[model samples]
Target chain A: MKRVGLKDVAAEAGVSVTTVSHILNNVQGKRINAETRRLVLEVAEHLGYQPNDLARGLRLRRSNTVGFVSDEIATTPHAGQIIRGAQEAAAQNGLMLLMLNTGNDRDLEDKEIALLLRHQVDGVLYASMYHRVVEVPQRLASVPTVLLDARSDDPAVPSVVPDEEQGGRTATRELLAHGHRRIGFVNNIDDIPASRGRLAGYRGELAEAGIDFDPSLVVTEDSVAAGGYRGSRTLLGLDDPPTALFCFNDRMAMGAYRAASEAGLAIPADLSVIGFDNQELISENLFPALTTVALPHYEMGARAIFHLQQVIDRAEPLGAAVHEVLHCPLISRDSVARPRT
Target chain B: MKRVGLKDVAAEAGVSVTTVSHILNNVQGKRINAETRRLVLEVAEHLGYQPNDLARGLRLRRSNTVGFVSDEIATTPHAGQIIRGAQEAAAQNGLMLLMLNTGNDRDLEDKEIALLLRHQVDGVLYASMYHRVVEVPQRLASVPTVLLDARSDDPAVPSVVPDEEQGGRTATRELLAHGHRRIGFVNNIDDIPASRGRLAGYRGELAEAGIDFDPSLVVTEDSVAAGGYRGSRTLLGLDDPPTALFCFNDRMAMGAYRAASEAGLAIPADLSVIGFDNQELISENLFPALTTVALPHYEMGARAIFHLQQVIDRAEPLGAAVHEVLHCPLISRDSVARPRT
Candidate 1:
């Protein structure tokens, strides 16, 4: 079958081929009417007139594709939301994602980035599965790049990451609003942004509420269930046990649940608990579903693509890099309640 | 800096441009020495030589890319493993994945498929997050396509899916081997392939064990934690409650755990429980952990790419389509134990 062309669609729609091309290509600053655009698109769809992307890319020196290079995306649960957000945003601009996974291998990442450049991708979304600091690949210097769920020390590369401090404040405020003055915080021991920012937020929120920051009430441990269990046990054994607990993440909350259950304390009624990183599997399934703060994983992804497009549209790197911090909203469930005291 | 070309690598390696091109492009049938191939690759890497894939693709009429169109990959936790598997396999063959996600919208799917076809993709991988029967898209008929974790009624379209029945049997047999004569099956109410196949496996395994299939022991409900809890509660409430339970998935098993806990039956001691779909978040984080059947998500993804490559390399669809059913492996965790009879 002879492939349908723009001329076929133009003839079918009774419009000029240039009108069809302008509307379909989505050329900026065009003065075409909306009705004509719709008619051309409808006719093009009905006629199955697929624009030859390869030919168009070669002619224009643009692939209409973006490179999505991530380190270990497949192993993380958060991968789905981030990738989905980026892909959806990219699709809105008629761009496809050329997906590659590096498995955190530096050498492999270099090769993959080179391959992406070889494909003539208009830009690259250098994504990380989790929010952290990353040294952008050296090869990406030649192309427009945006970081998703990650940042670099250099101020010249754009990035988008969740506001971990705000997320912690959101979680802490939820517990504080429940009229609990003495709240325990089960924090991760890592010195990463999440740990440091969350701790700062916790302290800052408590100060606003006029609650003295009690060093004895805070315990740091590994950010796993076992660690949460151990930390919760120690906190509960204190001379003046906290009426509420703020867990670092949902996994830690799951451990706290077990700890509370073992100590014969009912959730919300006996001990209010709040967690961060509302991982649905843990937050939703736990008995008395956990009240937690959510990471802006999806937003970070979408915004990364938006930022990359901005750079690509400019056809040059911005004089100053744009670093975006997205808000982490509170997800209230059954785990938080007013303290009896 | 000017873009490095094939001639640069050839000059650095003291080889002809033809040898470099053949080695770099991996053109088969030319017996190039292994040492010279390594030398060319090293020189190419050191010189940062990047092949112009666009020109190469245009010349060869091959994109060296596979279109990966999944129905809602980002919403499901299973998306990561499947994509990783396919991507890793593709990378091994020097191919890249052009990813597009259609959130199960038919019109959007049609448009996306058209876009993929226009890119001159060598083939397409139509993937589903879960195992199901799918009607191959009409537009996909023109391209070499393979189904991942899905199958079509037409045997001519290649597919790869998990052996759902075998997974069920594995879970049931684990309970039986632990000396549990009567076991409860908490199955999903949906009339999908997983529900039917798992139920059939339960009955088949019982028959093999010379035990009459007790219709009263099986309860169907939603495949969520609440459903699992309700189903388990009902089964445990029976006058002659089974000593063991097999849940449809990890989420359901989490519910089963709650029911057991409420009934004062310790896991692996008084009530042995087994689940399917080894979702790490649910299974690993659940108290007492969870022994479950792992759906070969990664394997299915890798195999799908392998199958697509076979069809593509053959330059034609095989006379007989290959429908491969990979085995579901048993992951032994802390859940199952011998009955206290």
Candidate 2:
């Protein structure tokens, strides 16, 4: 059987096609009476006259859809929060989110971008699992793109990222204000933009205090749980361990705490430690509440959507790169205290 | 300029449309020579030939896509982990994931499901932020859906959920094995299936040990960090607080730890606590380590996809309810100990 169309519905309801379209689209405050609107809808429903999303998408030249292409979803906990913010903003702006998991494959990322383009998505949000510099795939250059939780060295794309440098500095400053002169740094091995930015912040604060940056005091390891554990072992094994330590993220902080405990050292007494990302588990689980910096995950997501909308509405070529940095605030929990003599 | 089609490419390459179709679809493998394959690809690229995803979707009656509909992506950290698992499975099967955030809005859920149907998605995986008895929307009865971390009273619909009963039992068994005769239970409101399952498991274990189940030892509250704290305070206020405590989840366990600390109690020495859902932060950050259960988030996601594939391939009725139950394993850390005199 042939599918029903708007003309059939209009003829069946004895109304004009324009009236039917207006009622179907739910045009607000239209002069149509409730009974006429109700009659048109009933006729359309009886005829199973479903609107063709593709045709509508073509005519409007807008899919009312946005694509969020990310590498991995599960491993990066922070990305989940960011997606939430973007989803909320997109919904508020009358758009639906079309998520594409690239599975961290370069080739697959290229394919997914092309697929989104075919679907006629208005814009795309390229979210990374970690804070790393990503080379935008060639296919996505034509599409309006915004990067989240990552940065690009090329100044052609817009990026919304956490202020990792400020977070690091704020965490260290809190430790310094508590009189921790002999401080240690736990760094991750990955050379991502976030890791580098955080390290720069830690160094800047230490230099401001006129303390010699001690290479011997820095322990580098993976950013994961096991990496934190191993880093802690090496740091504590040193002959002259620092009285306080700063960790890149909460996972490493936990590992550092465990190492200190094994050595029979007390938190905030023998060793004061601060961490970044203010993870929910870290702040609540530690014996001494973790004093850390909270990454602006939700805000970054919302802003990315807002920015994408701007690019789409202006129809302006996103020639120059746009970078929006949200500051990370320090939460003074029980983890940090004055170093005891 | 006119868009190029398979026929246009065939004419340009001096070959039959059938041969061009086979070459473009990469079906020539052993039948075609390497030179021919390279020539076809080069010509296709030069022509800017793009596959019509909509036509392909209709021809195969499969979109090579799956819809992941979740209540809220940001509210619960666990949802991200589940998505990761499903994504991996989808990638392995050469399928793409189309994500929709319902935000726990029933109306939105209905609309999203309708949209997914319009897209002709292969199948859908419905994930709730937390485990609870969800009413399967009537509109989704025709779609092949597998629920993750959530269940419906309707057994016909297959669901993949964590074994909350096992999680609770294992946590209780760990404390009991540690020789704690007097144990307490900290749980969320029992209206949720997870909470009920856990409470049942806890009671079953105590009965198995010939120990009388003490109603006074059970404390119920919200499952958030603050709720855990408040619940722990009440549990500790009892005249004879149990030597060990088992929390419904890690967030609540964090609260219990805080309350125990404020009451001048030492973990394992004075009070040992166990939690469920071994969330990354909760297990790692809990002082002395939190002995908890690891929810099979990744496995559930994989299974949901596997089940969805079966339904999609069969072209089975979309609204039929399917059910599945996944198991949880216990991760024994260092928090439990023997009862103290």
Candidate 3:
């Protein structure tokens, strides 16, 4: 069967092809009453006249598609939520998502961004697996781009990232408010932005309480479960061990639980522990439910797409660099408790 | 910087535009020598001549793109890994991904698939938030399609899903080998394919072991932490509680753990438990560590793209139903143990 086109819709509606195109694309300044618009839509629907993206893209010089470039999809657990948000927002605005997986290779990212640009995508969403400052590839400069879960030192690029500093502070304050003073801080090496931001918050909270930060109480190691186990052991081995501990993320907090259990330390009796990023698995599986900060993963996804749509519609100027910082709520579950003197 | 095209590369390499096009696209039977191919590539590289996807897509009458349709990203934690796998495969084969989030709305799914078809995507990858079968919209019949992590009773469409039946059997057999005759099963409603398939495996193992399948030993509930907890309570409240239990999924197992802990049941000694879907958080957070099945999430993603690519290349005949069953591996941690007398 021959496919219906703009001409067909126009002919059926007794309107010019130009008017049909303007109405379909929602171009302003084409004076048409609601009655005429309704009639044209009805005619188009009856004829099954789906708008041809190829023809529309050619005419508008915009593909009505956005490219989402991410590092390995499997490694980053939170990224799926972000992608969903972006996809939903894009679809609502009649935009399609063209996704590229960089597999954590910088060279691949360069090539992928170049390919997206070659496709003339209306915008690009660059998501990194790790929360670190990534150097924006030069090829992406021409595209209206947004960074998700990763930040760039380059002020020219817009970024959407979790407020890790606030999350860390909230987790620490929750433990402190429960009347714990000698608290241990277990964290990954402060090389990544998230780690550094969290550590800074931990220290800030301690200073606010006029409690001097103890160097011996701080255990810096790997961020994985094994790393948390080792770090917890070291902290517990200290001559004057802390009554409570604050972990940077939930994975490490889980490791600390194992170390505590091996040592026969009853939770909230011998020690209290607070973690960040209330990973669903951790909150449910831990002996006592984990009291951690819940990162606004879904919101981040939704907001990024909303911003991208704004750039796509030209409602917001492209390359204006709109940086949005979202807050993580403190989910007070069962892990934390008062310090027994 | 005037954008370089085929003409510029041909002029620089002193060859016909058709020769350059053939060399670039790797078209066979062109009779181009190695020297000419090398020179043409070198000149194209020097000139930074990136093939415009828009023009190429128009010329080929194919988008060289695939649509990945799924529900909201936040609800489905497994999606990230799948997307990563698909992206890697797509990039390797020079295909781009068009992502559409349906938010689990049936009407929206129908509309988005229509939109993807209108965009002329080479194929579609329909992924579900969970392991359940939904009707594949009749409108999508014209497009080459693959279902990921979901199955349909219909034999017409190809599907790539994890081997949940084997996963359930593996978990149950592990407990049986540890000398547990009285084993209880905690599962979600049998409506879901994964739930039903897993329960079948559990029953099959018991039958093979010459053990009578006790209907009273199986507790079917919602697939959530709270549900697992409730289900575990019911099993333990019995006059003769089983020594070992197999949970349908990690979350359900976690709930069981809480119930066991509340009943002052020491793990392994008083009650042994095993779960499926080694969700990283679950295994790590569970006090004794969770010995569960690791779903082939990454492989499923890769396979979805592989199948779609096959359909697009016409290497595999179109409209031929292809069913690829992927396996899940048993990851033994600390959760399961020999039942004590």
Best-performing candidate as measured by lDDT: 1
As for candidate 1, its clashing pairs are none
Error of 3 at B268 (Å): 4.7
Cα distance off (Å), candidate 2, residue A98 = 3.1
Interface RMSD of 2: 4.5
**lDDT (Cα, tens digit) per residue for candidate 1, span A176-230:** 8889999999999887889988998999999999989999999999988888888
Between 1 and 3, whose lDDT is larger? Answer: 1
The stretch of ten residues in a row with the least summed lDDT in candidate 2 chain A is A52-61
Cα lDDT over the full model 3: 0.82
How far residue A294's Cα lies from its native spot in candidate 1, in Å, is 0.9
User: Which portions of model 3 miss their true places by more than 4 Å?
Assistant: A1-44, A233-241, A259-271, A284-287, A303-323, A337-341, B1-47, B233-241, B258-271, B284-287, B309-320
Q: After superposition, how far is residue A273 of candidate 1 from its true place, in Å?
A: 1.4
Off by over 4 Å in 1: A1-49, B1-49
Work out the TM-score per prediction: 0.89, 0.77, 0.84
**Tens digit of per-residue lDDT, candidate 2, span A131-225:** 77888888776678899877777777899988888888888898889998878889888887678888889899999999989888787898865
Displacement of the residue B33 alpha carbon in candidate 1, Å: 22
